[model samples]
Target: MKIVDLGDFTVDTQARRLYRQSEELAAEPKVIEVLCYFIQHADRFVSLQELHQQVWQGRVVTDTAVRRTISKLRTLLGDNDTEQPKYIRSQMKRGYQLVCPALPGEEPAVQSHAAVETNAAKKNKLIQSHWLKQLVAGSVVSALVLVVAFVLLASPVHLHTDYLQVELDIPGQKASLALSPDGHYQAFVGRVNSGDKWQLYLHNRQKGQLAKVSTPVPHVRFVDFVANGAAMAYVGFRQNVAELYIQPVADLAAKPQQYVLPGLSILAGPLALPNNQMLIAGGESYNGNIHYYQLDISTGQYSQFSF
Candidate 1:
């Protein structure tokens, strides 16, 4: 397939990086393979088997892997499911294709392609989905047990003893703060003027008062505190559009790394679980009923709350 330019983004086949304007968009290695395959085979709908073989090779892969990767790629490209996607488009039973325009950009070298068919891939996808549903159901049961244990065995008096209050102030803005799971840190959001000007700050409650946790940037909205207190989540914006970002506290001075939060904006109420994974409440707005999403720290994948 011929690579097309979309003005803002270019699929770099030779480099395996998706470029927006002049900057590279962060995408997983596997996601790049899947996207590059579609970009190379634009227009024609490529079946799941073909995509899996091309992207995953002879290795076994679950349908959740494909769906999750596509979902992540779409989010990375800021594509929405409601409209005809400007990046990837799904043809239901037929397969998936790249429909968005690719702009002028450098190409990556030697991207492996898959050669699987539609029907076989679809069946695998169904099986993967069925098993995933069962696993999620089991997780829900486990989660309920934990919640109940905390409620019954752990007395309210003991829970109240762990309570800590942290306050933060950002010069020239109204600040909002969220406490970490261990309650040792707080993530703050500051609004300078209105509409879009925002800043993210970290306050170390364990250090006595609220300490500045981050360097000042143009627009950063606090997303959550790392479950382990080693990092934080925030939303970074460019040209008015925003994307989710994760930054380790030790590397606060360096440019923050970006993570994909497909189709959603404004991740908040960051809670890091004991399992060392992160959780962020996501939606368009807080009052809009955000869905809680678990971040797989290892794969950077998102799993939605089942119950």
Candidate 2:
């Protein structure tokens, strides 16, 4: 039941685990023991000789070994100021003591509650702003074509039809673009120069703000807004293999879940369908025959479909 809340990190004494912002930190046994020892004896100073007898239990430990454990524990706690001593203070040959100045559980609880309130407020604002927008797309690539691939994709509304073309300030060549179903965001594939690697760029169309979407979307070749603007699915390559990814519109920065294609080698035609499903053209690797499939967005499963 003992937990050490160090403000920057928390320790589960029973599990011997150290965590920072919910991420489990890799620590040696000695590092955990040293951290736990410092926390349990925060009220008084701990001498080096005491640590050798108590924590190490006379295990033939050297001075360097003990110092290394202390150093590693400090790193895990993000304690950079050794002189001022934010978490643990080491006096020259005078041993060490925990100096974080918080009761074991008080600080982390306060921080977690504040974080929940801030996140709830932000989420409410986001949902309200997004609900006010809307995007119209009857075909899979119709809306996407109007954004990034406009110069190449053929529009059905007559070849010579004139429309106002407004260029965006984004650098380099843009490959693919998808407007959220509610027109709140734009997800596109772009690059810095001709040879630069392509990456997914998520733009808040309403706010005019831009950010780079992380991995799985890197080298992204195609993107489509799905689930009525709540999420998006895209085709990206990993290990030279074509993989599908699904990411939520609310959490675009989150790592997208990847889906592998079992039989189909060549994938094409991600036409939007009803019930959050999509139709894709799959071709056999050996034979040139193409097959049609229905992809379930919720499960990332693909099944054959007949015309």
Candidate 3:
């Protein structure tokens, strides 16, 4: 399935569903299906014949039917093609087009069985699996990203220098470490060499000296502290490509909980905010550039970071 996020609304082109935050916008099933077709072929202007072939599978339908379905999709997304056309664009004689910009490795929010009463209060969970599949299906191509970007958010709160300190391990080959808001613990990467082979080491603050911890993946290009310092978000590199992995910091001797976020070719840090939640940057290297996203620990929900 393919997923696209346009700030407030998330469109899953594969499933033909529109979600506002975490709640699914109620609409006719046919309308949702039509919207999906436009999103799948976002850049191309989908003609009536193409739309019918993809969405309806050669089903008979009038021009009025297509227009009405497109209209409903716009309304559900709080958009009007005539005014604020964020999602879809219409033509006089041609079919519709997707105007919203899609990010590489970006996922759309999927509404679960649960519903939220207010759109403002609901937090959308960006589903990555569906979006990744769609991109690969569209084009069998990939690219290489040379630079790794790091961004930190500013807040009114200040950390006591004594409680937390950051440094690069010797050569600083991997990403830097970050402390939680409370400052009870810290997380950083340790380096180890096995004769021509180099790897990142996972280290945490224990009783006294730093101890070695086994991560979800051994060799990684990036690592970040998450879950208020209870977990570490690390990325593994193979063939110059990276994928994200989440592991716990509780017991270094014990195995950590691992979560595989597919389609993520590169991941950037445990960027902690005032609320204590962490942000990680990730993307599909071959498809496009990277984008910043926030991850919720309690729910494991991810959303794109707005300026």
TM value for model 3: 0.44
Cα deviation in Å at residue 208, candidate 1? 6.9
Encode model 1's per-residue lDDT on 159-234: one tens digit a residue. 5544445344445674555566577777776755677567676666667554344443456655566646667766
lDDT per residue as tens, model 2, 1-307: 3766777677787677777676455556888888788877888889888999999998898887687678657655656467887888888767898998645552223336567668658645643444333223344456666654564465645555466554358768986677776778888888989887778778887788888878643467777777777777777765445667778878866778765555355665455555787766665453567866666777654545532
User: Which candidate tops lDDT?
Assistant: 2
Candidate 1, position 57, lDDT = 86
TM-score of each: 0.41, 0.44, 0.44
Whole-model lDDT, model 1: 0.64
- Candidate 3 residue-wise lDDT, 1-307, digit = tens: 4766765677677666666655566566888877766656777888877777787788898866666667656656556436657777778667778788654324544444343423423422222442455477445433212111111124324423465455433553334554544555555554544332234454434443455455545455556666656666666666666656666666666665444334455665545443446567776565677777665555444555532
Candidate 2 has an lDDT of: 0.69
- C-alpha RMSD (angstroms) for model 3: 17.5
Q: Give the range of the ten consecutive residues with the poorest summed lDDT in model 3.
A: 143-152
